[model samples]
Target: MSANDLPSLLSVALLARVGPARERLREALGQAGATLVLEEDPNTLELQVLRDAAPGAVLIALEPAIEDALERLDPVLGSPSLTLIFDEAELAARREGWEAQRWARHLVAKLHGHLDVLPPGSEQDGLLQPEPGLPTTPAQLHADAPLDFHVREAFDAAGDVPADGLYQAPDTLSEPMSLEEALAALQPPFSTPAAPSGPPPVPVSAPQTEPPRVPLGDHSSWSLVDDDAVAAVAPPPSATPSAAPPPSDFDIARLSLVDLEAERPADGAAAGAVLVLAGIGGPDALRRLLATLPAGLATPVLVHMRLDGGRYGNLVKQMARVSALPVLLAEAAEPVQAGNAYILPDDVGLAVRDRGLYFSADAQGVQVGTLPPSESAVVLLSGADAGQVDAVLALAGEGAWVAGQVGEGCYDPTAANAVVAAGMHAGEPPQLAQHIVERWGVSE
Candidate 1:
């Protein structure tokens, strides 16, 4: 489709298994003539998105597989509309963290380019550059050209060497000669060529001996005896002070990305995908958590959850029914299909590597201390033409889609707060509703 056509084409990458719903989605795409690309592997989805072409695309993750695609395709692809689909009854089921991480990486890859990283040499002021027509070659510049040269010249003028001496040149013999000839030439002609000029008439033999002694007058002797003599004496040792302590770690994080927008949606298409994460829950919770979102969110819902219990994904699916947005679960390492929810597996986590969601062998954990499961957030830019697009979603007022269970206990409310703080420290404002709830002490 043309670039313009693609934006309005209702493009979506469907990630779902073959089944009645899958077939139905395919039929719907066919009927609507939407540019729907069905991917069984998220890796393929990531790979298929070329940087320049992804701006108008949409991503529908019907299963966990979409994470793999996001990871693989992040580097070159842009963030697209994302949706997740799954059964509504499994609210308590554990979801995998890796899956959420993959999705986050996808978002990161898609939006990271938007970060306001200063170009080289821009951080500080007062850095000077050579004026126009100034010598570009180092050889032409003098070591002390601007300040010391003139001062040194003036000092030389006051010394015994006359200024005129600067203009004189040393004499040199032009012709080559054998040692004997050179010696003959130098011999008496060198007979000490006439003694050089310029010295005064002091006799060389005169000795520097003392003159006849005359005792000093009593006045000189009296001055010496009455003086208060001041002699130099070694001073006592002074006390040494202890060193000061180093700055706190918070000081470092403050210099980092605290409270910054890490990324933003590149276009309307991306805005649509961002809608999934606008509330404390997923597509299902849209109605209760928020009021009136833009039309982009209501059109199609994309789910990308990184919970250890599959139940949350199921709950989200149930809640999606209450809103106008469609919702479901995505599969692991599968291509995302349009108009469906994709759920991640609860056993192992997922990540976006290359261009798709790949299942990680590692188990999920929780958010603790200052570190959170930022890996998922870090990797999502895999195929993305943009970087940090996920950060932009919140800027557009849509919350982010996250599957917390990556570290020690990501689901704990305290852990959520830590993640939010970490994101804030990283300069990306926390865009997840759950993170906000934790920060504000809100509960369902």
Candidate 2:
């Protein structure tokens, strides 16, 4: 629909599961000025209801059973006028105060296709009222007077001085006085005289005595003690130095560069996947890192990001706008491919099988520990889960090249900070991307 054709008040079709969140969603929509044309459980909603209502937007509160509901509503997913908003049930259920306000603002913006929405009572709609009996013209206002007249009126009212003069001395200092008279007035009233001088006294003397002299011997020779006698009187050494042991023959055989190379894994097997764990501020960080990477990168990258329910589609669309690599929602049984990014959905389990990545319908905890360190690497970016820090550290210990997002760009760096404290590499997105490219022999 054209931007100008958008309505100020939107009609919404809320297809949500029956729960407390649904009622809250209804109230929020109402607050946003949206008229509820149809409200029904997502599973029971039919395509005909949507067609008849002609709602400006569709709001779906995603729950665990959302996949089935989505499958049922597949036919209407392709509508051109459909502006779908997917809010997580947990977030909606707990909306209060600021959360409710935020949701309402977002809903109104999406309905009107605008980024800026004015709050209630802020629109420019009516004329402002003037003060009662306020003058409207120059003739009605009081005539301007000189500055001196106002000063005179103020002084006269305060009774501080005469209006005709600017300065007035205090009553005590009204008359003039000589400098000598002022100095005498400031002096003390009483004074004291000096005491009489005393008579001088006489001094006494004492006698001194001299020391007796001694005679010097004619011979200068003196007796010398033997060094051997002094050594005999001293204690003997406690222990004697032992002879050094012979070096083992095994220690002489040094491992050469060839031996070290032989112990290393094959290049193909060593070049493993790069897993990116992010949350909160992940989107912008992911965008920057992905844009810098060339399409020649051989390591398959898996992104496990936390997102609100039903936002995966929008996330993919948003990432594609800035990324050079292909950004797609991961599907089950898809083989791991180089130069492609797979975003993990909340519903599925991510696993590696037969040297290929695959998704499973069975829900499981994200098993980052299973990735072989010799062939795998991980980049902890922005809002990565704090619980994954220990697992990522263990992976690093197994020879994995682990890195993290650092500096001001990373909003939630709890996981990243932990990874850094464990002696792993940390930098901005572009720097991390460069490290990956250089380590894996990627083109850029």
Candidate 3:
């Protein structure tokens, strides 16, 4: 099916010898707006899912009962479509980087209009070789699609941003507040009107007590209930302006690049960019994060998930349905483009080819190995790249922007320290998009 033809919601059933990989499955399916239902018995698992949603749904049964479940559901989920599976060694690998890379690769493949399952056994298991020359991989498929200049859509998907630090900025449209105005706003809600003559005297209604101050949360909304009262009693402007300098606490800028900002605008109107990073054990968090991306940003998202090659094809189809941006897997030898995302293969590292994204075998997996060029912008979902965190920092310092979700592996103090230092000194945090706009001078 075409990318746009995919469904919006999905329910997955996971069964294995051990407790189902609820967390992992949730993370992956969450990206596609799917809900994962965990159950103890495999037979009951099917009934539970059927009650909630139809079989056209995706069923992910790991290693143990995968084959049996697929065989049983083949006829039922086939017409509407169901993904039955067997074998799930990928989960046991413990190599987070490998899993994330696998996820990206699978996404690319599905986007390119191919959904072949990975056959077991062999020198190379999941990689597909198209007949003669129809670009088998997802990246290659991107080159074949249409290309158009997407304006502010950059922040929605496809690109990288600094994944650390508290970025802050001023809100451009906010007007500057004077000492009088500030004082007025801080007064109690049911206070008497101030005199309109000379500087209004401060109110005094206490024997020895001060009015409590109310704190505003991150987002605060207020309506001008007494505009007439405010306008009538408002003090007149000073006849002669004071010689003293302007107040140090005025808000004049159109946009604020505060450490707490969540999104950055694109540079000018060039192509829009978005950075996607997968996290381990909790796809729900990532999915929630992705869902909040503003609509109409046209941000092309390149995701880095830690999945197996076997599920890559299905993953892409799944992600496309839920993600704001169109999802496509990266092919063995394809070019990247706007309006489409390139998911990297398990064996490949995200890199830049002709200024677009490309994927290649990571000869040096995770730490110490040679990955795609350092300057390539990428969002690492999870893995053991602590040893190479410095290299990532160095590259980001040079020019590339990198964001990543720490994996389940034991935290590396050195890696955390290094990354924190880099973000504080060099990289930008994941949420502050406005700060990114100012620092990078991107306009969208």
Please report the candidate that would top lDDT against the real structure. 2
* Model 2 residue pairs with clashes: 272-375, 279-383
Ranking by TM-score: 2, 3, 1
**lDDT (10s digit) by residue, model 3, range 263-363:** 32232211324444443322332343344343333334445555533455555654444455456776644444444554555665544443444344564
lDDT of every predicted structure (CA atoms) = 0.36, 0.73, 0.44
Regions of candidate 3 where Cα sits further than 4 Å from its true position: 1-49, 52-279, 294-300, 308-310, 349-356, 359-384, 404-417, 424-444
On TM-score, the stronger of 2 and 3 is 2
lDDT (tens digit, per residue) of candidate 2 on 262-326: 33222222235789988776776887788787776867777888775556765675466556778
Work out the TM-score per prediction.
Answer: 0.22, 0.43, 0.37
Q: Per-residue lDDT tens digits of candidate 1, residues 6-77?
A: 324434454444445445444444544456544343444435444434333333433444444444554443
Q: Alpha-carbon error at 148 in model 2, in Å?
A: 39
lDDT of 3 at 92: 30
- Candidate 2, superposed: residue stretches over 4 Å from native: 1-9, 117-334, 339-385, 393-444
